[model samples]
Target: MCVQLQAKDLLEQPIWRTAELIKQSKRHVAAPDGYVSSFIDFIELHGGEIVTAASSCRVTSGFTDWRHLGQMGVDFGWGNPVTVLPLSTRRLLGSDEPCFFLPHSSVGEGKGDGGFKVLVLLSEAAMPGFKIEIDKFCSQEFGQL
Candidate 1:
């Protein structure tokens, strides 16, 4: 389930207040622990308009945290995964390309002070420009050396 909040509300509120808002949203969506066909019917009828409107928005956020599910620990004899990657967003529910928050491997490149990875999908044409912009930002923040 996804939650939506206004940018103004998020930015204007203090951390504690923002947390409270999140809690409120969660409580508002609380459902019984069982398959509810009514919920699906309700969303199918209403979600189309919301999804269409949100597609044109400047940004949309989604959470894909499954760390609590111990996704990283699963191994089919190949060994633990170094990273989990998300597929393209060609036919996803949300308008904007969804972002994924993945657990970083405790070893290798992901290790060091606390580190996590965010996977975003972008078009092939956008890659070069995005790479340049990211490189520029990294050079500025990490220094020219």
Candidate 2:
């Protein structure tokens, strides 16, 4: 379907809330297309960001939310799934910031507690400060932030 991305202080959000927001956004994703009969015409007049799921999809700045298909108990007759690895060959189109959301690993050593893993890409100039901010969040217990 479609989804909207609204900026927020992600690092401070609890995992459950994050998941809830994602679930909620999934519902509104297709609304613009269905509600606006001249959606294409509207985009043509106003311009819009291109969204894609291609392995090589690119974005100047955006996020990929894999949580919908993530953590599903998919099996290929290899027994119960022990983990899920989310990846893509896509590179940031021209954006300085991009983020990927993937499911957390299985319990015990691989467990992410109750949260998922997020892969964030930022410019070299921003890494140091970003690292500090992340460190602050990680200082708490697994689900605390």
Candidate 3:
């Protein structure tokens, strides 16, 4: 489900509140009676508005949480995956940049590092700044990069 937040709402509300609102909205959408019956119905009702809104946006980012997907345990005739990576393309959401929250590699049955991994895709021009910020964050969090 896609939840769109207005800039004004984001700026006006605290981040935790915004996140709760999004979670509530997602739950509402996921309810059995919350959705349209068909794609045609959805398009007829909201397609034009969606297109216009998308056109007005200069930048868009997408995020997906795959931590619950158990991707690391998927074995392809070898062993559990050492790492899970997302494709750089964002055709799924039409985002310019995308971030994926992935599960940590499995060490054994019901065992893992108890941490997650984030895979981010960004423009080449943004990489340096992103790296610097990430380094800063790492140093602050763990006392080293």
Candidate 4:
């Protein structure tokens, strides 16, 4: 169910947006716009150097079903994931290792000051470690550090 967004001059042009629909056995509702906005804004504010306009929502099966993205957390238990959706290009910037946003998962609302910033994925080889870290974080203690 993964999609790739080819970049167009530093922006992911052919983007794929997922719908927000989830049931964690607690809440059965679609994710709010605030959550999505907060995420996109956070990246821009932090110098994402957005070469293209900001975007949210997804187009799937001839329908824009952004609501299904909620399963990224509610069903997958990754929390409010602000996935680093690769928008196309692998630039020779940022981390020196081809700066790009790869899809990732987390708990709680992302970047809205409701969830902790976790994981930095840039390659396929890193996924196993990422998941391990996620599990460790979830099992670890949390509170005022």
Candidate with maximal lDDT: 3
Error of 4 at 62 (Å): 36
lDDT of 3 at 43: 80
Off by over 4 Å in 2: 1-28, 32-60, 92-96, 110-113, 139-145
What does candidate 1's lDDT look like per residue over 1-74, in tens digits?
44566878777878898677667656655656422455577688886654432565665655565444576778
Sorting all predicted structures by lDDT, with the top scorer first, yields: 3, 1, 2, 4
Cα lDDT tens digits, model 2, 34-85, are 5244556766776666534343533345577666684556767875466565
Candidate 1 TM-score over all chains jointly: 0.59
Clashes (backbone N, CA, C under 3 Å), per candidate, total 0, 1, 0, 21
TM-score of each: 0.59, 0.48, 0.69, 0.24
Q: Which has the better TM-score: candidate 3, or candidate 4? A: 3
Clashing pairs in 1: none
lDDT of each: 0.62, 0.60, 0.71, 0.37
- For residues 7-125, could you state the per-residue lDDT of candidate 3 as single tens digits? 68888989999788878867866776764344457688887643322545676677788898877768899988877777545444557776788887565554675788787888898
Model 2 clash pairs are: 2-29
Task: List per-candidate RMSD values in Å.
Answer: 5.2, 7.5, 4.6, 17.6
